[model samples]
Target chain A: MAIEHSSVDLSDAMILEPTALADWIITAPVIIPLIAGALLLMIRHETRFHAGIAIGALLLALLGHIGLLARVLETGPLTMTMGRWLPPFGISFTADVLGASMGLAATLSALVCALYSLTDIGARGRRYGFYGFLMLMMAGVNGAFITGDIFNLYVWFEVFLISSFGLLVLGSERRQLDGATKYAILNLLGTTLFLTATALLYGALGTLNMADIARVMPEVQDSIPAGTLATLFFFAFAMKAAAFPVNFWLPASYHTPRIAAAALFGGVLTKIGVYALLRTFGMLMPDQLTLLSTLIAWVAAATMIIGVMGALAQTDLRRILGFVVISGVGTMMAGLALGSVEGFSGAIFYAFHSILVMTALYLLAGVMNGLAGTYSLRTLSGLYTSHPLVAAFAFLLFLAVSGLPPASGLWPKVMLIRASIDGGAPWLAFAILLSSLLTMLALGRVFLLAVWRPAVEPSTAMVVSPGIGYAALLVLAVPIVWMGVYPEPFANVATKAAAGLTDTSAYIRSVFPEVVQ
Target chain B: MQTLIFRTAAPYISSLMVLFSIFVTLRGHNEPGGGFIGGLIAASAAAVYGIAYGVPAVRKALYFHPMAIAGSGLMLSALSGVFSIFHGVPLMTGVWGSFGFLGATVDIATVVTFDLGVYLVVLGSFTSIALALEEREDG
Candidate 1:
């Protein structure tokens, strides 16, 4: 059945597109955090109370996003035009099921990260500014997912970057400074490339909106250099996503911060890059994407293997989790490369699942390190006996992250495997399975060294922080089971989100009306 | 050698430049001036202050930490987006209304809010880097 929709026709006549309150609701996911972030900056002096405000803002944003998700599910994709300017003249915000769902997930993750930071950050330093930066990062991630304008995506990237720099260096320790410098320099380079690509795309398409570019891209094949522009966009996203060769920046830079900061970066930052990749290639430049998908698949395979290998080599607890998170990026991108509905769905599902699982794992690692004194495997032991509750939660998160049964990670892997087999890429499926097994092995190693090994010298005792870390752990832990046990609801949302992404026509119709021949 | 570099650049040069940075941010939307450039300029101004004056002097002169300013800028920019919802528009959408500016109508758009957000973000971010580097130098 054809979806009944209304849109403005600016090509010939200036007709107002029929819109709804739902449009406003869909945009709330981004709006709430943005507002909260602004409110947060005003009262930075109340250092003691800033956590409350930050957590409150995150909770409100989560609620607002949940409300938006409900409306989008009841309806279809929701679209809003900025400044009442007609499409092609003004920017648009589109909340397809995927964008809103991912947005909600991002907000929820940020909220937990904020809670986690309360204890994690306070112990390391007293930087009240981190909360505002966290809020800004959330705003950037949410904006990137929902934005239908290409240039706005770049703006959102900057937002995420600026805040990220603060969070990375919040402690101002020697290691943090070094890591932040590297992180900042690499990300700045990525931003430059991204801006160049954006300028080139605008020059090629004459419009900066994604939907407009998609509509005009096919027509300009003969006149413009689509291949060159597509490559530019692809390379920029690859660097941002940390795919293979460009992936070094992530593991090198991410390990320097406190657990809460690391958790947020692990969960949200890279995903923004992944989201851009999926949106731009899957929607805007579909034909050119097919040509590049094979190369991306190889890169995905390499990233997976290398990331897992890197994880195995790490002695630091946060570093291991960091590598695992990087490896998972490959799995997500692999599904995107497959270019099948099931593959895309699996990719999006994996992304949703990984954010929860990885964030929880990092928090759990933080808890262990807090209790055990040091994050080094050689330094930690008997965590299971001393902190069984933490062990159980970490174990569950481990199983979930490793794609083991009774958790959400399994289903996405299953879907990805099936998609690969159906596409006749048995080697790709083999690679994914091998990576999953290796991921399981890597985490198992962490579990062994961290939980099962004999207790070390009695002088080094684990001191668990009260209130903040435990509270954050509880907040993140609940969803790992909820999403795993009853995956249908979120899975449905993800499928809808994936479908919205794959169907460029629907996106076009939402942004611009069909020009009369 | 380092002190020589500091002595070469005038002490007021940085503060004067910072004032110009604020000007760029304030007038961003209509002209080429916007938050990113303005923030960068402000940051450079602070960096100059750091070199000409001692790091501690620069820090004391600012009164607030560089990171705090960045945080405040981020908040301001984000507030601009949030304020649009009261007018029944989407987040980050430019909402235009006219107000009397000395008997002349002035357009207040949401883009201005966004620009302000950008301004704060750039200002806060760059200053933090500058301050962090200064602290490293002292150590």
Candidate 2:
């Protein structure tokens, strides 16, 4: 209890008057998929219908998120509490530009993944609740991105985690079980740390609403070990984001699942952790973020270098992509470590870029694997001649992910590196540059060996994949190419989103508009 | 162990526990019991029945796949929240209604429906896990 807060508070902070009906769109992103997912459960065995239902649900969610982003951009920020309860007592959903854009990116990535699932998943997989898990996971991811309640954020984490556990083990393969085990143990530790930190945070601040905590953080900072709490949260989120030291879980397990599931994990899952870190530090406690920036910078450097190195050493295409995913995490973490508006904006932009490009890469992996009848690079070759269209898609995603020109990945990397150098961290900038080079090399090698090299005699005939898989990949690829070509609008959104995060006044005020006076 | 004495009494014990679970669920809004705890209690009843008899027997008695029940429970919970959208309020806003029967008022609320959904989810999820484990042991 901030005994000090209640005295000066607007006595009416706890009450509400009737609002416009259209305001309900705030929760539509989460609610849409949740209802659809639950409905899909009743008929879980109907694989034929599952893909359509999942796609429809995801499209609805994507539209809702697009609407939310547009609204937040036009307005400043939006806030809605569950059950019409007052702030601090009821869980609130705060949608600022950052959260809305991320939600939109996540929903779009998920929709593409769902579409890919149609080609990648089978009747047996569908019967086991593939689409249902995808929807539920999206619910969790979107909820976490936008929730204004820290405890509710934890709940959303569990929602996604449980659904991911289901997604990871969809095939019941030995490799999947082995991978899921590592994924489970480490992730469980992360959640436990998250919960413990949340409890301590609540104990320190006497509130679970995120904005109120920020409002009271300055006063509470002196008495509590905010650093320790921050460390706990950092580690928890780092593990989730697959940052270095605890990131082994991602590369180990992601490659084991269906490529569709892996795509979701690679593209959207770890980004949740990154989003949580940015939201907590950038918005909730800017001082702690500043204090911890040096250590974060070191982590960022190590992650970038190590992640790319790991990718270079892998021969399996999926495994190589897994490490590539980790490398992207390092780049985003660099953005956080810099702690500038450009840095945050760059990170946000990268995250959206990463979601689209990474998911597309994974979908391409599925397509390539389908055609080659394997994920092994050693036995695959001559795709340039045999499947030029598929090989063309692969080349575009490669350029995009490697931070090359004419692709979305280039802009964020530029912004982040420039911000790092400008912020007086040349070494951090160097690490990012080094990672980009190594990433380009590693991925280019994948293309050279798997797609362009002279024909290797096929041990087996290529598996003809469905056109839907290519469609899904195309959906994800367009944004990367378009955003690259038309960077001004998207870059503007990223900057606006970052501006909201670096200055917490707007975010906090969204939650407690009356507290401003 | 599926002993004779336990098997003989399992049915009656399960029935009583289920009845108590419903009581707990209904009273949850005003008291300590809610869908979560009530569900656990109901699940324990199912587990006890499975221990005395078998998974097939419990499955037959239940007459539905446990996961299906869980899924429907989720739908119900979501719909209860959506009920507020019809009233032009934020999601999960509770709406209250009352009916008169023989000059006595009967109150109904979306909150209870949400709680009941939670109860079913807990019951279904726990029962399925317990049944799966037990069935594996038997086989």
Candidate 3:
């Protein structure tokens, strides 16, 4: 794909240039999914067609996102001002390397999840509404990453939350309903806190723009009563990210959804919270971050240990994976606490890796449930015999999650550990290593029970659709290995993105040059 | 007699409430009223309609599906942010233009457009949930 750069001279009276056609790449990822979602709603009667269109839209989104990421990498950050208004007043859509890369990861995961749903859920029942909800959720996740405004982030959160509510309850089982209520209440509380934080930030600074806030923060840091507000904001994001002490709702709520839905939720949702935490701390309040870093580090350690313990106790495959997601959250945060470039890059790279590995693991679990007629560990056995492909894919993902060599997970763990050691926090490094061990143990238990054990009743077998299952597995599996093997490009981009976030000077200059005044 | 009162009072009250919601949504940018409040009002209207009439009856009267409304609202709100492009502004930048109408100056902008979108989305989502739960109970 050819990358185009456009610049309109703003040396005249206006502070910024109007948006050009080049801006389309920034907004297209959000707009396309939404348009597809609206189109799906119109054809609610045609279940298969809706599912196909939804999947196609996600595929197109994934491709388009890659193209956009290429453009951002070739150029610097790709920014499009809304309605052509300048930075302080209007909302901006930024395709920074980090945001675009996350968007790409999310879109790919959604695409695989969509495909898996078509086979798994379609076999069980017709759910056109579910497809529609899935599309909306995709739009929310994409938009949240790319948006340059805090309030816009909140809106996207609601967009995703509303659809998630629908997906969580689509099964209408009693457990699903109960879980949905708890999920709904907790998420609502989180969003409300997020909204209030936005309001408080806006009130403090008179601006809601992320770049603009970064510019203004230093002047106000001393007079603005920073610590308390910062704590509130941290708590709010931590709740959303499902950090320790606030993470109970995730495992409780996630396991009740249909496996396909649960896979997407596990893969994409918590990352948004983590993304927000990283963006806010790294960009908006870097000065105060030092104070909070210790607290955040402890949270990461606790979340990691607690998450694995929770995973070890789970008898169900989906629930166990859900808890594993919780544990991995700590690993991702460890990089941020180290507060070094290597640590930050490792954290971000690990985040990207976790998105793929977790989704693949969950997708494999969904396939297992489809084949074995149950997700219970007691009921499932010896999938290596009948479903060798599924077994192989599951084992690959298990290795990836365990941070074993030759897989994507190992590199990020290595980088994080190195960063921890360099930062003189060997204890943190040890905690990460310990967490990895527990994760290995937790996943090892699952692999043994799900893949190695002999099937108790060969007669009671559920037929797995080889075509879709293999396709879905390949979709995620390829990236897991490719990224693991050749991670330099991603690492380079992540380093630049992290630097851009930390320096804040490039972001500030981009939004407000000396000429603007 | 109570049923008669509900029958007599519900439609007018519901209609008035929806109209008020529109008012709140339109005025949201300058003042406190906006899409969220408007959506709540409209959802309340739907609930009252549900109670006065049967849930099925209310759902039938809602010609547009709730989810569709919510989805469209989301699109509209997002589009409002994009609208800033026309005036050479960034996304979600507020733009205002005024025209004289009916011996008064009338102003319109993307923020109001966004609020209107929010109204539709909130109304659609809340009402859909209410209607779904009502249907479940009926069954």
Candidate 4:
């Protein structure tokens, strides 16, 4: 195969000598939960111990991610090829700042979700091995983040998909089954598209290692199929991320699952799609993305408008949050479409913010549903008066997500606006502003109707929610407030991560040491 | 609905299929047949049993739970990867060990262990789902 690489000659690109002991950190995040999840499946007879094992595994993963992040931040990206094989030939898992940070966010969100599951998951869900599925999903998420091979990314996606399929139908309710069917079918389509694109990409570039493809992309002659490859990837990722046109599945199905299941999905699943989009477009295919930037910007605008409009029209609280999740996707997509350092950084920042805040929002929604005995806004009232702590978390998340000041969401919006103007697209900035307004308006309606509305006897339901659920919500909320208060450190990390995305020299050098002159 | 011919032949047929699956799994690292294929083959054996006899008979033939088997397979695969850490290599790094037994040398590799794990997981997961659906149908 004639591989045209306009970048540095990779013939000289040497693999880095594996660090003896510390390399385990790179694999720990994926392996710990995987082994735990597998073992948990064996002991399904004892449901009581599943939650503890899952939580412990997640905490270990989180610590590993934190360590990996710190190391990557201090050093550069850390790369390891499976079986100590050479790069390109071996599946490599690399943790750059962007990947590690996202991994950390995912692990944190998953840990909270696991904790919340202990209180929120019913006996039927537990009996069906919810914790085991949750751990497996976490392993998949971690694997996807750190994997350096595009093909491996697809594998991880499947792992998560299978586990999520298990989680989605854990309750086996009629509504859940209906939702899972739609979710499964659409996602399968997306997966097929992803695989086809990946095959074409490998055919064109003659390599599946992401860094190698990026290194060689400039040299590959532009063709119709090349353009189609980008479009295929866009559709595949967009469907998963629940972008404008293909977002119906999310709102249609998300609210039907158990609250913890929905919360996990809301928190990290779509964000994985977003992460893949940003990684591919921002890092691997920046030049191609620049060509399609205008179209992408328009998609961003439409997604933002449609998502908020959908949220505005929903009467169910979780459904409203579901729409809000879609709008958040649009916001990050707008940043991604700009295809600049500021834009990429903003997208990463917003992704972390979205993951945490969305999970917290859904957890709060679950709490509300538990207390009121229904998710319908028409029947639920006096939450602010009855459950002030829960109501406070909801209000904080609402403000944060609406891009209000003193919240982390505002800083990312500012960066995206700056990037839009800098990238010569003022209309995108206007779309973002307009979308934020719509989000506030839609979410404000919910606030007025559900929280501020007059007392309606407080629908005294048997709330079996344990204190851990509340604790999980609070644990997730802390990061949003902290990031909002002190944006500098986090922004610095994001800025460096964004630099890694745009300038792949360091990443390529890390993976292929021999290539560096 | 069970046919007399199927009931008479199922035991031998399933046993042979299970043996073939193990053989395929053991050779998967060097050849086309690995854990996934072996698992499918094994699961098919269970499926055949279910069709000829019933879900309960199939379940009894496979003493352990299908989900548990799958989980154990997953643990085995993960541990195989972790085993390299003890050798100061990256996770999933292939490490080989050989021992001289009498006049023959016995060699072992983590890849084969990992492959076996994959086989068990696939066999266990599919069979469990298949049994669940089939049992539900019977009820």
Candidate 5:
């Protein structure tokens, strides 16, 4: 049935259309983690077995995503409706190149984190459903990336939040409980805002399918309370993304959890918020986005400055990394604010690059925590002597995180800067460069204090054995260097993904097939 | 201390509620009663029984941890989708089949399986949480 809302143009309406190629692969990335998580909960006492299952499930999903990415890149977007129903009536799972690539990156990060958890997560944490919650969080991230409906996105967000809440409080320490309380309260507020926006949008549009909303947005752009809806969406996603003025929850709570959970959250969680922002503003409301580009640019600049300044003041390794992740969000937001093809492509590439780099950085932070028996920089030192490999990986990831040349982070910054100049927003470019400079100083201070200086007390001894976790960290580093050395293939994929986002007619057509006579 | 009269009636009342919950779950295919509501009904029945008997009694009756029930439900829900792949449909797409037993015809679909999963997951997770809280109070 066609949505016959008065605001929708007859020309834009499409009748009940069936999907062409029902690719089950489009849904596997989400379902695999979900099923694995459920199974992990069943086998809770078998810690080693749970670890194996978690890592295996993530690897399977990663492979599935790789194949799905290739297919989507080759044959446009893929769409499938649940329960064999048509698009509007059923929940639709649609994955374009962007979604597939993001899914791949997230799954890869999760796999590495799971591998690290083998050594890191204690028996108590394992008994408390660590792997289950981790897998659940991964499932939520993948589901959010692939779903084609707004309400479905909300459901996935809740899934992400609930699992993350459990994972955050896995240890049940006083600190963890405190962190979880703040995290749960703030995140729940964001969720409430999101649900409010969804209710309002559905009330106005009479449709919850994203493609249908995008098709009808132009018609109702002026008639409805578009600005308020847009603002609500912006705040909701911004709170989740940890953008400036609403990012305190991240640094506060992120450091309270164990390294594995922290690494997963650092890598994939907030990025989902960024992905949602791109999908909603970049695709669903291009006209409004164009109108608000200047506002977004200022917000981007402020987010970059505020986030870096926040990082500069932090002494805890995880907290510093947490703030750095926020700055990375600013960089991506800058690209999005530019609202150009080059800008969008830069944002997409940076999104994936940041995922890998931040996850690697956090994993290295875990190794550092092992080396010094704490996460505080004041108590950490002499890592270059005792554990050279961990120090080396941390240094390299820092360079990548701060956008130094010959690192993956530099390429995205270059594209974003170039786009800003061409798009007549050089100030945004300057904001990015300034943020990178400040981030370098902040992180460089971390390096000097944590790596160069001698230990505050030479009597402090290293804690645990660095097993395959170090290898897992190094494996994540290889892709960062690979992207830096050979940026062409990655750039091409990102450009295609950006093109798909800028033009959603293919996505719309894929999800809502042409109605046959 | 257990109230003799309430304790005496709890078993019969709880058994009926659980049976009613299953009926509600089965009718959810075309009616308003689905897995979530049915599961909540079942959990409340268990909670009422626990109030009369004790946390230990409810735990013994459940046999498996409530969280395990939730996990199994999740697996069932997800597996229902995987089954659709074998039928050459998209993920989570419903595939229907019919069978006759005892000279009566029975219809089944993947959606029903998914709903049953949801039911178990809700019933188990909620009851477990309630039991945990009630146990904490006792301790």
Candidate 6:
């Protein structure tokens, strides 16, 4: 894509005036973290300041993404091409409601994590680069969501993957190393598959821009192994999402990191996989997605069932939360499998919903660990008598995660179930209900054992959860509770995002205005 | 393990490679050479120097922590893109600047600053890793 310096007028296209302020909004989520993370990395000995900068960086990124989301919701998709090069030539960052909302949600969750790290992350962990890696991961997550090119998506994947690897083993504990080892091997495999799929798709279509590929998919479908390529993409994202049998690595490794790190991982890490699925299959290759819908539905059911069953078997609180994360992925996958406007909306809503709720759940796990000095459910008791507010927060978040009424999780689950029924997939509807029921049972059991039951023995050490820690949980809880109470505004955006994915005309039009069909 | 001839030749090779690395970085957009390769060459020069002398000597010569250099480069690379924001363009849009001095014109671009940042990051990270490995070996 070399620019031919044929004339001055042609050169003028290279430096168009930054009209309309949307251009800056399009790329700020990525660049802010890139600058802030690197700056944080240079200062090796200031935990207080490092945490402050990390929070500031994420807060700024979240604000930018909020602006981006508002613009996308008000108007349509936003596009920014690198070096002023047009699409199918230069790399582009394109954001629709789906990407914009995802970025904002991830940034919000990450901001909470950064704040919580102030009290939760020890000086040793801060010295080892907690905030730096967290910001680095946010950059990757936002980039993956916003990029219009498939290859750029893979590049962003690697960026976040490397950062996660850094965060996973930051403490260099034996268990952390062991968990990181497993995490690395599986994720690398997933990344390699993703790269392979991207390469093969590029070879088949001769283009890597997502919108370009979608536009050309019909013309090229007959010539290429489009189904297999789609499956390759599906397989890569499924493994990454920890859906069904491919999910072992998530449970094995996710519980090992520090809670702040784990909260971020639980919040947006798996959702990235789900987001990629939605972008590639829902928006970019709907036909291929339709072709593979049934198999995906079955996989989704299995992922939901097995994930909750694993949670039921786990006594480790953090470990149970990891399984709960896996089950939520199933719910998102089920939404993907439905392949309807409602289903897509449900999935989009669920991913953002899960990002907020699941992250808070993990942070709650940390706060509980701070209070009770453990992650094990067995030796913990009488949380209600001691910390009624913590118990109440736990109760609300559990209600949300398990898809009980009047919590954020319930809306997405209802949307998904309704979508499945409307889409004539009663079995999927049944599966969703059954998984939610089991999740409630599992979490209810946790509540009974940890919060309701009296103390098994007299407690010795009293480590009250830090003020910042509660503030972090409060920050996260407010959103979950708010979304639960008044979901119309957010749900409306989700509907639009789903619509944008289904019809990608606006998305494609944003990237290449002249090529709109 | 270093012989007299090897030690004597190392310094010349190292210095020449460092010089060539800068040339490569300068000609990066026009030619095949770029910041990444340039940085690799520079890092290799440092490694060779460390082999000839010691990690301590290389550290003294560098005068800054390798990670600090890498971090500065990251900041530079990121800020280079930020320049476009103030100028009213998307991030990474290449804006040009020209300066007239002594009846001569000098042109500069954000892309070059980005490349330089990439160079420093690569050089810093690789040199640090090399230093760490060599220190462990000497220990």
DockQ agreement of candidate 5 with the native complex:
0.55
> How many steric clashes between backbone atoms does each model show?
7, 0, 18, 7, 0, 1
**Which ranges of candidate 6 are over 4 A from the true structure?**
A1-19, A461-464, B100-104
DockQ of each: 0.27, 0.56, 0.31, 0.60, 0.55, 0.57
lDDT by residue (A124-231, candidate 1, tens digit) is: 254446776787788888888888888988999998898898888886789989998888999899989989988988777789888888778879866888778778
lDDT of 5 at B98: 73
lDDT string, candidate 5, A1-517, tens digits: 1123235654333223343444778877998899999999888777768888888899899988998999999999988877656678678888998899888998999999988988788888899999999889889999999999999999999998999999999878999999999999999999999999999999988888988888889888899888888889988998999988888899889998888889989999888989998998888878877877787788888889999998999888888888999999989999888887899999999998999998988888888877678888888888887788877887888889888867789888899999999999988999999999999999899889888887678736558788777888877988899888888888898898889888888889887777321
lDDT over C-alpha atoms for residue A352 of model 3:
89
lDDT of 4: 0.87
Better of 4 and 6 by DockQ: 4
Candidate 4 lDDT over residue span B78-119, tens digit each: 898888777766677666876899989977788888899999
Interface RMSD, every prediction, one decimal place: 7.7, 5.3, 7.8, 5.7, 4.5, 3.2
For each candidate, give the TM-score of chain B: 0.81, 0.95, 0.90, 0.94, 0.95, 0.95
Error of 2 at A246 (Å): 1.4
Please identify model 2 stretches exceeding 4 Å from their true place.
Answer: A1-14
TM-score of chain A of each: 0.94, 0.96, 0.95, 0.95, 0.95, 0.97
- CA deviation > 4 Å runs, candidate 4: A1-19, A458-460, B100-103
Model 6 lDDT tens row, A1-517: 1233223356535534454565678888998898888998788666668878888889899999999999999889998888776668888899999999999999999999888887777888888888888888899999998999999999999999999998999878999999999999999999999999999998888899988998999787988999999999999999989988899999999999999899999999999999999999998889999899999999999999999999999999999999999999999999999999999999998987899998898998888888888788988888899889889888999999988767899899999999999999999999999999999999999899999999887667578655777798888888788888999988999999999988888988998887737
The fraction of reference A/B contacts recovered in model 4 reads: 0.82
Q: How far does residue A354 in candidate 3 sit from its true spot (Å)?
A: 0.3
Best by TM-score, which number? 2
Q: What share of the true interface contacts does each candidate keep?
A: 0.38, 0.68, 0.48, 0.82, 0.65, 0.63
Docking class of 2: medium
Alpha carbon lDDT at A201, candidate 5: 94
